[model samples]
Target: MEEDKFIELAKKAKYASKKIATLPVGLKNTALLNIAKNLKENQEKIFEANKRDLEEALPLVESGELKQSVFNRLKLDENKMRDMIQGIIDISNLEDPIGKTLLKRQLDDGLILTKISCPIGVLGIIFEARPDVISQISALAIKSSNAVILKGGKESINTNKEIMRVIQEALDSTRDFPKDVLTQVFSRDDVKNMLSLDKYIDLIIPRGGNNLVRFIKENTKIPVLGHADGICHIFVDESADLEKAKRVVIDAKTQYPSACNAVETLLIHKDFKYTTELLKALEEAGVELIAKPESWHTEYSDKILSYKLVSTLEEAIEHINEYSSGHTESIITEDNKNAKIFMNAVDSAGVYHNVSTRFADGFRYGFGAEVGISTNKTHARGPVGLEGLTIYKYNIEGNGDIVKDYVDGTKSFCHKEG
Candidate 1:
């Protein structure tokens, strides 16, 4: 599409977002349920479209032009379809995040103040291969009363278009639901256009590999909320339980190797007695361990893990803090004090103890689904859910209150919380 055309769509989205912001919770939930129902009824159509995408992607995968992971994500099955539809329903069941009273205070008689949660207006979401992200992000936007413009990977173009069609049809059937609340764009040029439209796009979320995310962040002046790397880590303390360490590390690295929360690096205390056994166990589980200094900062996103020997718990913490992408880190230890210290000092969005890093997910955290994991220090961090898409506004109620009277001390002020 042309740049001007894209901007026009953005303007419509901005207007629609304002309209959605005032929609009652019941209407939003009804729309979500409609989407879910429509998707369930049209599952075979989606599968047929996914089959076409897979057929096109097969040659690219074979020629090494496309990643096998991307291909795998593009090929949706019955299970994925079921999960996607059920995810929308689950989101509709969550508490409405908008219009909640965060703060209420009384400054004086007949003067009250309130801080109420509200939508962040229009969002521009750019993601790769995973067509499921379309449904998840669309559901999140509706539940939170925010508008979204989505750009998906070319590899999943057919599947994305089909899914979006179903979603739009469902919205059309629903009463009082704004169809412009969700929009889809296709083309590399669309991404470029999206980055430049910070005036209409309140937040830009890029969900893909390190290179893609880095490109988006470097080129956009908009407030980009995402992590470029998923260089997560796990450290095994000297007091760690041998069985637990092996179990957790295996799950973290081999459960779903391509996941962002998968552990890419493993730290072991130099004096830990089970180092040799743990390494052997990981190798048996199909994990290739690399112990080079250069591998510390790598996010393998595969069955490859970097290993290191730390002399102390503090050294382990320091290594993780230096090398991790601030995504998620875990410490496996029996010592409570070390666990507390590690959790406090790691400085990652998710710090765990004696558990697999794979637990670092929004749906697992019970937010139903997430837009994406944000490693940013400000605004939303971790798995961004419904609440993350909202900002708050202060509403003050007063009957002809004058600021001059307070400034002149003619009226006494009482600041009290309710």
Candidate 2:
């Protein structure tokens, strides 16, 4: 599409977003339910589209042009289809995030102040091979009453198109749902265009590799909300239980290694007695352990894990704080004091104790679904959900209230919370 065409789409989305922002909760839920029902009824068509994507991706995977992880993510099985349909329904059942009263106060008689949650105007979502992200993100956007413009990876273009078509059909069938609430772009040039349109795009969320995220952040003036690198870490304290450590580390590394929350670095106390056994267990579990100083900063979204032997808990924390991407970090220790210290001192979105880093997910956190995981310090962090997509605005109600009266001491203001 031409640059002008993209600009037109963005303008339409901006207009639609304003309409959605004020929609009642019932209408939004109706749209979500329609989407879920349509997706379920058309599962076969979606699967056929996914098969085309997989067929194209398989050759690239064999030729080493695409990673196996990407290919696997592109392929949609029965289980993934079921999950996708169910996810939308789950989102429909979530509490409405908009129009919630966050604060209420009485400044003076007949003068009231209120802080109410409202939707962010527009969202720009760029994601990689995972076609499931389309439905999940669209559902969240609708539920939160925010408009979204999506750019999906070329590898899953066919699948994305089909899913978007199904979702659009559902939205069209429902009454009072605005058009252009969800739009998708399909070119690298579109990404460039998206970055430049900060006026229409309120937030830019890149859901892909570190390189993609870093590039988007560097190029865009828009506030980017995502983790550049998922360099997660796990530290084994001296008082760690060897069996627990092994179990947690193995699960974190092997359970969907391509996931962003997978453990990439392991830090073990030098004096820990089960270091040898833990390493051996990980190796036996098909984890390729690399112990090198240079490997500390790498996010191997695979079965590869980099490790180091630290002299003390302080050394472990220092190493993690220095190399971590501020995504997720865990400490395996039986000591309550050490656990508390580790949890408090680690400045990351998710800090866990005696558990696998894999638990760092929006769905697992019971948020229904996530737009993306964020490592940003401001706005939203961790797994971003409906609340993250919203910002608050102050509403003041008064009858002929004048600032001059307060300035002139004619009216004494008493700030009281109710």
Candidate 3:
């Protein structure tokens, strides 16, 4: 597609988003239920498309062009489809974000001011081989009343098109939402077109490796809502409970080694007398420590780990500030004072205490499901959930009042409660 064409489509989606923002919660729920129903009804078709993608991917994997984990995340099964359906219904049960009055106050004379939640217009999502992300992003965008355009990787083009077809069918059945509100571009050239549609795309969220995020940041003028990597950390304070720390660290690192929130660096408060034993336990559990004079600055996404011994709270703070990817950081401490200090000092989107950093998820946070975990401070910070998908606007009300009386200092400002 040409750049101009995508810009035009994005404009239409923005126009559609305006209408979607005001849609009733019940109506949105109905659309979500219908989507779930359709997906369940057409399981065989979805699996067939997935099979083709898997077969084509096998040769690439055998040639060492694709990782097994990437291939697994790409190939969809019945459970993945069910999970996607449940995620849609889960968003349906959440409260409507639009028109939520976050703040209300009275101005001079009779003028009233209100700040409320509203949609951020159209969003562009570019993700890797996870074909199920198509539904996940679509559900969150619609629930929050934001239109979305998806650009999945070429490897999952066939699967993506199939899922997009099913979703568009559901949207078409509604007849109110524009079918173009959900679009999937198969061509790599379409990414350039998407980047050029900044005038209509309010935000660009890339869910993939560092190179893709860097490319989007450098090439696009639109706001990007993704972190390059998750160099997360877990600090064991001197006042920490040794047993709890051991369990949480195991869950954080060994539970799922490939995830972004998995612990990449371990910081030990030097006052902790059992630091050596803790390190030994981690090594016994198959964590290959990648330590040097300054290895704490590294992020290990594989079986690798980094060890750091801190003399004090200040040293732990320095390590986190020096190495963290600003994603998720946790502290395992029983002392309230130390926990407060660490929470205040760690510069991350998620600050956990007495818990694993792996718990940093949209579902775990009780927001249904996550489109992606974001480290951006402006739009979204932690899990990009339904609430994160919305931005607020001011809604003013007045009883036949104008700014003329207040501007000249002719009227005094008064606070009133209704």
Best by lDDT: 1
Superposed on all Cα atoms, model 3 deviates from the true structure by an RMSD in Å of: 2.3
In what order do the candidates fall by TM-score, top score first? 1, 2, 3
Query: Cα lDDT of model 1 overall?
Result: 0.93
TM-score of each: 0.98, 0.97, 0.92
| Superposed model 3: Cα runs more than 4 Å off | 67-69, 75-79, 293-297, 415-418
For residues 171-202, what per-residue lDDT tens digits would candidate 3 score against the true structure? 77975655566777767778888887777888
Report lDDT per candidate: 0.93, 0.92, 0.83
Descending-lDDT candidate ranking: 1, 2, 3
Better of 2 and 3 by TM-score: 2
Better of 1 and 3 by TM-score: 1
lDDT of 1 by residue, 138-240 (tens): 9999999999999999999999999999999999999989769999999999999999998899999999999999999899988998899898999999999
Q: Which prediction has more favorable lDDT, 2 or 3? A: 2
Among all windows of 10 consecutive residues in model 3, the one with the lowest summed lDDT is: 292-301
Model 1 clash pairs are none
Each prediction's total of clashing residue pairs, residues at least 3 apart in sequence or on different chains, is 0, 0, 0
Stretches of candidate 1 off by over 4 Å are none
